[model samples]
Target: MPAPTEMPTKHSTPYPTWEQFQQMEKRQDALEKRQDTTDRRLDSGAGEFAEIKKAQDTLRQQQAAHGQTVAEVREILAELRELVESFGNLKGTIRVMRIAGDVIRWGCTLGAAALGLWVAFRSLGGGL
Candidate 1:
């Protein structure tokens, strides 16, 4: 019996022409350009967000200052109210003192006049 002969193997090769290589390069360049544009937009958005955060911080600080100012004003108003109340009490005391002084003065004057009349009656020999 004769031995079987082996079949010959075929080798494969890829051949890319110059025009095809140029087209691929152009496509890659376009893709890179689009990616760069997208990256720039992302960076701009991030910067804008940072600015907004700074503005929010400034607003919070201003609000805190305003709150402190309001508290101070309230304290001042309370003190003023207390002062006014004290002044009113003082005025009432002064009015009461004035009324008492007037009463004492009138009582003393009437007593002196009555004593003088009694002395005159005695000197004229009037009966007790």
Candidate 2:
């Protein structure tokens, strides 16, 4: 009779050693530790996200307030422009009045000089 050969069954691993089981358990433990670290990092990220949202809100409010201030400044500039235009018109009117005053003063000076010269000539000619 021939010696019976050991046959591998379809559903069985011939043999898994004790060391292999221990290695698998150690790998599982390491994986669990890595998962815990990842979870902690994700929790910290959520807190950072909340802080970023708060900062964004603060910036939005400041932008809104600045817009209102800009509008007010524009209004003030418009009023200042109108005042400057009025001042220009008033300056032109004052210049016209100054010219009229100078013309009257010169006319009076010439008339007085002419009258004085006529009187001097008449007195000298024996028509005192």
Candidate 3:
């Protein structure tokens, strides 16, 4: 007969000793602790994922609002461009009117001077 500590021969299967069973129980306890830690991390990760999803939705809404704001800004810019063009045309018309008024004023001044000279000449007996 072989002692319990001796290696098994080819014909017989070996059974675990008391020490080996205790080591296996300790390893099982460590594995269960590691599994519990992993499960806690996974639960926290699920919460983080929900937070990230909420933030993404908020960003999407902000992006849509920004798009609308950009469109409104473009529209305002277009209207401002049209107003600038209209102001340019109005400036030209004002310039033309000012030139016409200057010409008329000068014509009236020259006519008044000529009439004064004619009156002085006729009174001095240099009639035409």
lDDT of each: 0.88, 0.88, 0.93
Candidate 3 lDDT (Cα, 0 to 1): 0.93
Identify the superior model by TM-score, candidate 2 or candidate 3.
Answer: 3
TM-score per candidate: 0.57, 0.63, 0.70
> Which segments of model 1 are wrong by more than 4 Å?
1-26, 104-128
Which stretches in model 2 have alpha-carbon errors above 4 Å? Answer: 1-20, 100-128
Instruction: Encode model 2's per-residue lDDT on 68-92: one tens digit a residue.
Output: 9999999999999999999999999
Q: What are the clash counts of all predictions, listed in order?
A: 0, 0, 0
**Looking at model 3, which ten-residue stretch has the lowest summed lDDT?**
8-17
Winner of 1 and 3 under lDDT: 3
Error of 2 at 96 (Å): 2.5
Top-TM-score candidate index = 3
- What lDDT tens digits, residue by residue, belong to model 1 across residues 1-60? 222454433322244467778999999999999999999999999999999999999999
Report the CA-based lDDT of candidate 2 relative to the real structure.
0.88
Model 3 misplaced regions, further than 4 Å: 1-17, 107-128
Give lDDT for model 1.
Answer: 0.88
